[model samples]
Target chain A: MKNGRDPVIVGLADSALEGGRFVKQASVLGHCALVANEALKEAGLSMKDVDGLLTAGMWGVPGPGQLNTVTLGEYLGIMPMFVDGTNIGGSAFEAHVAHAAMALREGYCEVALIVYGSDQKSLRSRTLGGRPSVLNMQHETPYGMLTPVGGYAMAARRHMHEYGTKSEHLAEIAVAARKWAQLNPAATRQDDMSIDDVMDSMMISDPLHLLDCCLVTDGAGAIVMTTAERAKDLKTTPVSVKGYGESHSHWAISEMPDLAHLLPAAKAAKRAMEMAGVKHSDIDVTQIYDSFTITVLLSLEALGFCKPGEGGAFVSDGRIAPGGEFALNTSGGGLSALHPGMFGMFLLIEATRQLRGDCGARQVKGAETALVHGTGGTLSSGATVILQKGLQA
Target chain B: MSYDNPLPVIDQDSAPYWEAARQGRLDIPLCADCGKHHFYPRTVCPHCFSDKLSFDTVSGRGTVHSFTISRRPAGPGFADEVPYVVALIDLQEGPRMMSRIETDDVESVQIGSSVEVIFVRATDEVTFPYFKLT
Candidate 1:
């Protein structure tokens, strides 16, 4: 049974590896625990202080033999009064923050923990992008259609056909992210990347060069949240959760309603910015999830940073790079930094890091407010969160 | 290693559509209530969500809404078909479906290209509705 708990923001921590290097043969639960313990330590509290637990679950349908919330709770050795196994693919963790915030505000539980870890690259596991199965594969799978790149390519192709967005427009996003990566030591790729280098890379899918795709690195990220009052008494400065919102339009790429429009982020970002009482220009820094180059472009357009078809032009010629107006993806994002399958958790961790002034070299200067957006399920789901440096009255 | 291509599983609502594809015809769900057509043949009308639906044969003509040239195979099953073209086909009857665009050269297919559907039997389990430039 559980009792009273306060609403506050306290600790934030990621896994041991800040970048692409990962522990081979590592279990998922081990990754989850490692980060949760690190977060608990950072909060100046022990595991016993955590009365509530929420984790981004395995991205799939739950059946007889799947990882359920109760199973994960038991694995973590925490008997929480409240639990959520909401799996919205990459955007799951951002949604978890909103859920955790509600739980904390309503006094469901205090000291809640959200964690995500994936061992895709090291183990070469097929948790995703595996051979089709009866229950797992979509109808389009039999037609030589598999992998997320194909679906994302379809959207990019549509955006090109409709808006005349060139591959160079997409290339700029990859360039900016790689430039950010160069400043961060922990980032996976260390090459001096350029837009030409991006264009020179092999085409994985038409219009989307190899550079446009994200690395399948194995990693984990976690964050702890308590009430603002409780957070103030803690060790490190609490990164206040100003506002968050999440929404999804469809599950598959083929069913995205319109290829040119990214409605999930449009709707979710609107709700989040409304709740935060901040306009587009007020955002000091943004950690837009860069699962793919087009993902960032579509997100920017959908979130109203640019007009509908002007995302390409907006990122042109050193716009979103290191000293660009947006100060976007300061952690190099999933592109040049790390992408361990579910990337929503990493966005929160990065946003919190920027707000805390903990990000050393690649940190945005005097970064007060940061917006994190995560797109999931082949541009199907979108989640947004705004984190501020100091607590607001 | 006896490998097999991943085939589409026939479900309750989509069973009739796949069966029709096996017979070299493109049948889509048409809702009598809304008087509109929908793709990926389902039990309920996507427009009105009405159960009053039936599979009807169509002209199988559509224009390419968008497309991609997969320089790499999508998965293990598509390894042989590298550099394939997949397109989102806007049906003449007013619905869109995802299918492969069969072309000798990728340059021939683009947005708004007139395409017609043709059933290409992948395996005994299922036949796919492939589109080709008209």
Candidate 2:
């Protein structure tokens, strides 16, 4: 039984996605500086205040080993007490948040700066070389089952087969996300769209339309975490790390025992809630990773937000839409918002903003407790973090 | 770009499975120590981590655990084969295999539905296994 830790999100920052300002190259280290500088500015601190640095592996750069954590730390001129470069797919950012929280609780470091950035869209093509690994690439890629969209499409197909989930049910999730994006000025997809329109759009993978998939954008996001006691003296309100949990079912979708159920996410969510000592009803907002529409539905069901296989029905009732009972993805999520490869940092930043009542038009009413879920590697791994407005040291 | 002549590279780890596929037989490694079967063709059993393993031919009969219809082409070479079905078939012999689902209508394929193995020769060097509704 792990108790709660008081790691506060003292600073949050992200570079502009429009006009290609901060990110024009494929270097992960360059984007790290952009996001880290913004976060320091927001905290009224400098790079000298950071003692720890964590980064995700750069995908856009060529060669096997281009960007790593130690190299990133050396370039940033910050000699930290701890350094991490754990890549568990896109959810690496959420894992970094959990790592920072645990390090703070154990008194490993005073301030941990977690950063993730990518130029996948501008520099690298979406297509990747097929490497034979026992986990994902070897199992399904041989028969033309490559790419994340295909992997997620396979999961969506299984859900439809078991529960009779229609394409419209999946489209409703996209519709809701686009609606939220319309309210956000920074959202990439601001155009209004209907469920039918989403269904009629270009089909990338059967059961998953183009709208169902997330955008691949060149962007970067960063967050600075400190102990709860030190957070009080910071510039912004501290959103305490109430609870967190993580689990991995397998490394690939083929190794997943059951496609209709997300066991790891369910187990992680249950443990997170138990540690936070809060129920589903206590959560005023949620920021689930929306790499695909099916991901949100599966995560919603796995997190106990709704009954199993009822995730398709839950979103259809407009519950997760803007101005609905429960606010979700106020930043428009990865679907409509900018997807910077490892987009989990954006989820944490949005959750912190929502809990602090900073989302002017997309804010949830009186949000006290919030939940954020991050899924990585074809739903193979997941991490859940719970946040609250105030906490006692 | 001409989307043709995509070759399957064989490494030491997957050489056995590829050789078996060329012989028109589906093979999986069964560990004698742990008495368990595993997929993706590994030298050591994932359960007990023992290298003492033997290859065995299965009945090639199983049920569809789950499947997905890929609307997008897998790569430049597979652009013509869009809207193909990829499935995870649970073999009766205890190992699950990942293969393409060969059925006219993907809608009719149900979970736990019966299926059997069929091999297709993709190139001279490699032959792949596929599953079809029985």
Candidate 3:
């Protein structure tokens, strides 16, 4: 209610999710409704009490799932006063939290529900090479720049070129993520993983092994938000939306201002932490989007957790693994856990658990604050949200 | 994973760049207002928002800014071109662009290595710019 100045206006009450390794066919809308119901149930709230709908449209579609806001609202048959159909790719859900908080504070709605579900794996879908935009389809696509994996690989290669970052530095992240996935029952890659194992995997692009890329799986995640005042009346403890911000520098990777200076994520994190009155060192846990190892490395340095060109070194020696000084992607992340294309929502879900002292084996002990960062497109856009444990006055 | 290579969907903003490529030349937009260059040709300047832009042909020479020797085919269309090098080249004219380094020795492409542009005719009228080690 304080124009988002204070970090206590909105809190995530509950979330419901369904995902992973599906052999049967299902639509994006069905997953949306299922997660919405489960999320509301966790909050001990019903369809009648739901007043707002928030979601990033399904992934792999030509456009972000912008249509689902209406189809989902109609399918659920919930007449709501508020609906947000914003879509910015993987980080769209993170931006939704910012929108929901502003909406709840402005009295546009209470009990905002955000949902995401995708069947990319079940369908074995591969997004077409061409982007609808003239620049992508015509200006850029002809250069063999069709694959997102190739774009990210170029980034890693760039880092290596600039900072003397070795493939082993990136391999540490994959190995650490797999280590955490071993503890997460829901993670898809549960096999015992090692740096050698990652190194041995066939190269998808030069410098990135198959294991270095995020797993493709069908999954959904949903979370609920409400005014801080109403959170006191909810069944579960509230995780406050202390600070959040989103920004985009360019839609295509070729246009990024400078790879050395990571756009969007750097600016978004600066704004989020500035609003929260917290420093990078104050963060107890991090749930950064990991579409690839380079994404996480760039995000860490961009978010000011480490200095520029030091991300590859900062993540070395198992520093981000469980029981390390700095905790990152504690949910196994898109790397090993469920990644149905848009994996931003799950970052919040895991961050909330860490803040709530609920992550059993992977929990950061006494974690009171968690920073969630999401990267969309070929590192084109970014969103950062800081969450802290809520206590009544 | 299927047949034909993913081709460009040419439009107004892109026609000139494609046209110049077919002529075996590197013509990119240089903003007359900000006096800078940019890639993925745009209607106006990204820096100064200047509509006064011109497609100037420059010496097709640049240095490798960053590169990856992709051991796997980036697309099924490139299946025969496995272990190719894709690089972002910084032109002498102060703009960077992404293209493949067309060379037999993929291992020789390094950051700061000099490269010269070469045109590969993709179609009767369409050509794609590639980099050759200088």
Q: Which candidate gets the maximum TM-score versus the true structure?
A: 1
Q: List the RMSD of every prediction in angstroms.
A: 3.0, 2.9, 2.9
Candidate 1, residues B26-117, lDDT tens digits: the string is 99889999999987777777799999999999999999987788787656657777788978889999988888899899988888999998
lDDT tens digits, residue span A1-393, model 1:
011243445776666553465743457777777788888888797788888777765532345116556666777788998778787889988898888988888888778888887776765764324435342244666656546777788889889877899989999999899888888777888688888899999988777888998888878777888887677667878777778899988764567888888898988999999988899888888988888999999999999999999999999988999887779988788898888888888888888888888889888889888899998888989999988886676
lDDT of 2 by residue, A119-173 (tens): 7677654563244434335556677765677778878988988788888988888
Superior candidate under TM-score, 1 versus 3: 1
The TM-score ranking, best first, is 1, 3, 2
Q: What overall lDDT goes with each candidate model? A: 0.81, 0.80, 0.79
Cα displacement (Å) at residue A227, model 1: 0.9
The sequence of per-residue lDDT tens digits that candidate 3 reaches over residues B43-72 is 988878999998999888999887767676
- Candidate ordering by lDDT (highest first): 1, 2, 3
- Pick by TM-score: 2 or 3, better one: 3
- Local lDDT at A95 for model 1: 90
Evaluate model 3 with DockQ and give the value: 0.56
**Model 2 chain B poorest ten-residue lDDT run:** B1-10
Error of 3 at A260 (Å): 3.1
Residue B2 alpha-carbon offset, candidate 1, angstroms: 9.3
